[model samples]
Structure formats: C-alpha cells, structure tokens
Target: MTNPLLYWLWLAERPGCSAKLAHRLLHAFGSPEAIWRADREQLAAADSLSRAKLDALADKDLTYARRIADDCARLHIDIVTADAEQYPRQLLDLSDAPLVLYVRGTLPDFEEQLTISVVGTRRATPYGLRAARYFAGNLAQRGCIIVSGMARGIDGEAHRAALEAGNVTVAVLGCGVDVCYPWQHEQLMQRIIRQGAVISEYPPGTEPAARHFPARNRIITGLSRGTLVVEAPKKSGAMISADLALEQGRDVFAVPGDINRPNSAGCNACIREGGAALVQTPGDILACYAHPRQPGAPRARKPDVRQEEQLHLDSPEVFAAAPRTMRTLEGGEPERTVWQAVHSGRHTVDEIVNETALPASDVLTALTILEVGGYVLRVGEGFCAADDVQLPQQTNEEPNLG
Candidate 1:
C-alpha cells in the first residue's frame, strides 16, 4: 500500500504552488491522492492553476518527498496532513492554510483549549521580557497553551515561562521541526519538544530563511484563539502576526507600553488605531473570551470607547477601592519567602532569587502564585507588594534563607 502522506508531501512540495493554489486544487480534486492521479486535462480543469503550477504539479517526482518522509521517520517527526484528525481545526479556517504540518512532540488539542500566541521583537527590552513572562506564565497556569516562535528575547521568554509554569507551549517555527534556526535556542527548542511541540509547515530538513517567517506568522496566529503582542516596533514580525490574527478573525490583544519607547510603537499604534484591545493583565484577555459568541456573530474587534467607559463605570469599586488583596498568603514556605522579598523591596525576580536564596524556578512559581493572589503586583519589569496587603509580623532575627 502506498503511504497516504506521500501524496500530501507531493502536493505541498510542488514548486511554485502557493497555499491558495493548493487549496483551490483541493477544492477541485477533493483530496491529495485524487489530485496526484489526475491527468493534465483534469488538472487544467481545476480553476486558477496557471501553466507553471500545472506543469509543476505534473512533474510527479516524489523522490525529495520520499526522502523527507524518511528523514521524519529517522528523526521522529510526525507529518500531520490537513485531513488528519489531529490537525488543528483552527487552521482549516484559513483560505491559505498549509496542506501539511511537520511536528515534533505532542500537538495539544487546540480545539478544546485556549491557545494564545505571544509574539514580539527579538531584541526585547527588560519591560517586554518581564511582561511576556508575566502574561504567558499566568495564562499557562490558567490552562491556556502558550504559543510562540521560540526566537530570542520575547518569544524565548514566553516559552520559558510557560515551561516554568509546567504547562504546554507550542513553538511555530519558520524552519523545519528537525532544524533549529537560531542555534542559540537549541536547548529551548529541545525543551519545547519534550514538554509541548515544535511545528512547521516546512518539511523536515528545510532551513530557515528570511522569506519563511511572514508565512510562519500566519500559522502561529491561525493555531491560536488570540494573539498578544507584548512589544513590537512599527514594522516588526510581531505586528505582522497581530495583523494576521485580525485577518484570521482572531482576537488581538496588546500590552500597553510606554509611549516614548521605540519598541512600543507598534502596540501603541495598534491600540490607538483601534486594531487591538489594550490588555492590562491576563484577566483582560480572559474576559473577552469568557463566553462563546453566537453563531455567525462577530468576534472581538476594535474596542468601543463608550462601552469601555461604561464598563469602568459599572465596576467603579474595582478602581475606587484600595489595592486588591487576599485575606492571607495561604501558600507554604516558598510563597512566604518570595512575598517577603517583594514586600521588602526586592523588586525583580533576580533580586528576589538572590535575596531569598531560592532557586529561580521556585521564585518564579511563587511569584506567579503571589501575583494571582493579589499580594504582589507586576510593576514595570519588577514586582511590588500590593498596597493594603498585610504581611505576617517578623522577628528581629533574620528569616530563614533556605
């Protein structure tokens, strides 16, 4: 019996075949297998296939595709075709969705869970990195699968935080799943594969190129319920992802940043132009998707100033009251140590880890808990104790640093 994936690989790897054209062909022929067996006249009958695409489809050379299948088997990569049950239904909504996806590790059930793409500049600032960590980590703890590119800076921080939160994260790579583009992220890539997945539309052994990323951004946003831009310049790839998310009819959320910063320009523009909703916290994003929309109803779009003001007015107590606080720090030793450090002015995670002499992972976990419980607030790149939250009395003796 012929490998069914061979037909998919052939359709995907055909020279000059764009996703739109492939989709058109799929619509005409119904399946890759049927398209592969179709004659020249049959292929010509398909709409929008130019002479070059038809000739490319006629070449019928499966040698390269066979080699890719071999490479996937040898490297333990899974090739998910568009028709596969495991293929994300979210991507199918796109008119130009990839015909195949190469995956390493388990692909989460994206249809059943909330998946948010966290994207931003590769050269991220301290504020961007911290915001990425805070939002991605907290969202992951809320059972949202974090999706990112696994690039340097913001993307890497998002993936790492999700992993640190002990939740799944999907990295949509421009390069092949078998190849790591930015050699620096080899360790991070490996961790994602072990814990979640690293996926690409490119077949195994395809190297990363500048042109691949714009297409890669579509997959990133397509696989998620929403996209969050932590920070971006006016013309960065993250902005492209946000635009693509909007085009895909997915919710676009951006963390508001300082107006003076160059890296923040895109996010500011997105919010100012009413292209994205301003996200102050993970809760803000969560609230938009809390209830399912009615069939054929519009997705979340540009926020209405009047409705926003009304919302704020309706919840005046939320802003009028003292800083929100939990009754007590109910967590055990790590939480207490981390909270004490933050309350005592150890603002950054590095400072808390150093001052408390706790492992970075423990410090981060504690910080997420404390932030969620309203004992600590994420202020800029660091943290601060929430006002009006009372702490247990301490003795003159130094607290245990263990």
Candidate 2:
C-alpha cells in the first residue's frame, strides 16, 4: 500500500482521468487509500474508467507521486484533499469543487473569517481601477479577507489595496500555485502569499491556458460569501465569475459604470438584468454579510477626489458641476461638433446623435478625443462637461463611496 498523502496525489494526477471521474472513483471506493488498493476488476466495475485507464492505474508505480510529495515538503506547499480537516468548508459545498487544492501559503479560517471576491476585466478603465481600490481598501480595513484571481487591472489593484491597507488578501491562480502566469506579477504574488495565500487545483508545473481561467474563476467565488464585479466587458472572464457566483447561490455586486464605456458595459448589464445588486461603497457590500462587524475595525481614510468625480449616482450631483471644463476643440470638425452637443446638454450617445445628426460611430470617436483632453467626464449614463467640476473638499471624516 502507498502512503495516504501519495494516494491522494495519485488520484488527482492519474492519466486520462478527469476531475469528475476522479471524484466519482473517490465516492465509489470510500477513500484514496481504498482506491489505490482496488484491483483492476473493481476499478472497471466503477463503470467510468476505460479498460486502458484501468490497466495504467493498476500497473502504475508510486515513484512519481513520492517525488511530488517530497517536492511539496521542500517547497512548503500544503496539499488539501476533500476529506482533509483543513480543507475549506466553503469549497466542499460546491458541486464542481477541485479534488485537491495546492496551497503555497497559510489558509485563512473561512468558517470564522469574512471573505469576499472582487473580480473584473484585465483591461480596466481608470474609473474602474479607482473603484476597486476604494472598495477593497475599505473592506480590508473592516477585517474582511479579500479574494481575487490576481490578474492585471482590477484584480491586481484590489489585492494591492487590501495589503496596503494592512490586511490580508488571497490570490487564487488559474495556473499552478508555484507558477505566476502574468510574469510581471511575480513580486505581487509573493506579497500575497506572505499576507494570505496563493492556491490552485493544478499541479506545480502546469501553465495557465485559456480554458483554465473559467475553472479558476469558480474557485474564486466558491471561496467567498459574495462576488463583486468591479468592471468587465459584456463578454469577459469576470462575467463568467459572476455567473458562477449565481449558480452557487452567492450574492453578486456590481459597481455601476458609464453606459458608453465598453469595459463597464457588462457591470451595468448585470445590474439591469437583476443578476447583481448595485454597490456604491464598501459598506454596501459589508452590509450583506450575515456576521456582525468585528470590534476594532481599522480607522478609515479620506476618499480619493478622483473617485468622487466618477461616481455620481445621486441625481443632484450628476449635473451639479457647471460646464466649466468645456473648451473649444482646436483639433478637428468632429471634436468641435461632439463638444457642442455635450455642452448643449445632449449628454447620452443617443441624444448626441440626435442633436448632432451624426452617425453613432463618429460621435463616439469625437467623444473619446474630447475625453482625453480633460474636456469631458462620464457621469452615470451621460457625459458631463468637466469645466465647472470642483474637487470635493477634503474632510477629516472617513470616506464613503456614495
């Protein structure tokens, strides 16, 4: 008989065996130890393993599994199986949960800790980035354990914000726990492991592929009480994460974004379709937790002025700033025309099209140019002239996104 830990590793790494099939075998046999001891006839009787697979399993040696166990010991990686006492309670309830999890750092006590997932598009806009930092920082200060994929843009921003706020954050990877996919984030990954953990279902050498991301996303939401979409396109990995959150009976929250921005389109759509609740501040998300606030929450800091300009959910503030940022476009006829429409209060794309009597594409192109010049700012679903916009006066009070 092989070592118990080796058997578990072997069950997950068996050739041609899918995670689903491995899980079925575990259920049929009672344990990895029992499965390892089962004869070929019994293995075949499970009805899922092919004849060739049965032969391979029956004839295979434990040499490789032994090596892997040794490597993990030397690397300080923890192998958590479904039956392990240290396995996350939240993941066990998931239907498609991984058979085993490879963890490179200390795992938090999910049963006692408040965990939330923050996800978004890799190509996050400046507005989306600010929102991610604001919410994540505030939530971390309140003792929440932030979870994310550690991808670029919003994911990276959220993790950094949490750590910067003197709290912990978990980074669940699409690749191996040892392999950092976005090479540039190697340092950030180390920072995360120190503060929280880096975990994955794949073995230590597996590279991140396109197909691995959706599978990875499931774990992100599975580990949390709720999932937050900071920003995402209509068709993106973040939307897939949101769908998984719904499937798992978890709450979904989306930070509202401008309707005209492609990166924000999915978030707005999620809100409109009633798939997620709109969140303006970290407190809104914190309210969803069933647990009471932990005593001694960290002191809050002043909100960034740039974030306030972009989040104009209240009707009074949406158009409160006078059109003081407006300026004559010296560049092209299209820029001047689009500026005129926005300055004239034809803010929405449809309104601009109607007022300018120009094609939607032309209007959008002109708006982009004007926006780059600091002449326009997005407010809700409309465009606002930035001329009269005043930076909010700094206050000693703690910042709130609303």
lDDT of each: 0.85, 0.79
In candidate 1, stretches whose alpha carbon ends up further than 4 angstroms from where it belongs are 301-402
Runs of candidate 2 exceeding 4 Å displacement: 51-56, 290-402
List TM-scores for all candidates, in order. 0.76, 0.73
Residues 1-402 of candidate 2: C-alpha lDDT, one tens digit per residue: 556888888877787776777777878888887888899989999856777789767855788788878877877889988888989989877866788899987898887778889999775654676788788887888788999998877898899999998888999999888788677678889999999999998878789999899999999999998899999999999999999999887778998887777888999999999888887776666655534535464211223445544543232222222334534445577877777677655657888999899999999998888788876766434575554323234479888989
After TM-score superposition, what is the CA distance of residue 394 in candidate 2 from its true location, in Å? 38
Error of 1 at 9 (Å): 0.4
Model 2 poorest ten-residue lDDT run: 313-322
lDDT of 1 by residue, 155-273 (tens): 98899999999999999999998888677678889999999999999987789999999999999999998999999999999999999999999989998877877889999999999
* Candidate that scores best on lDDT: 1
Give per-candidate clash totals. 0, 5
The TM-score of candidate 2 is: 0.73
Q: Residue 44 error for model 1, in Å?
A: 1.2
Taking every candidate in turn, the Cα RMSD to the unseen true structure, in Å, is 10.9, 12.6
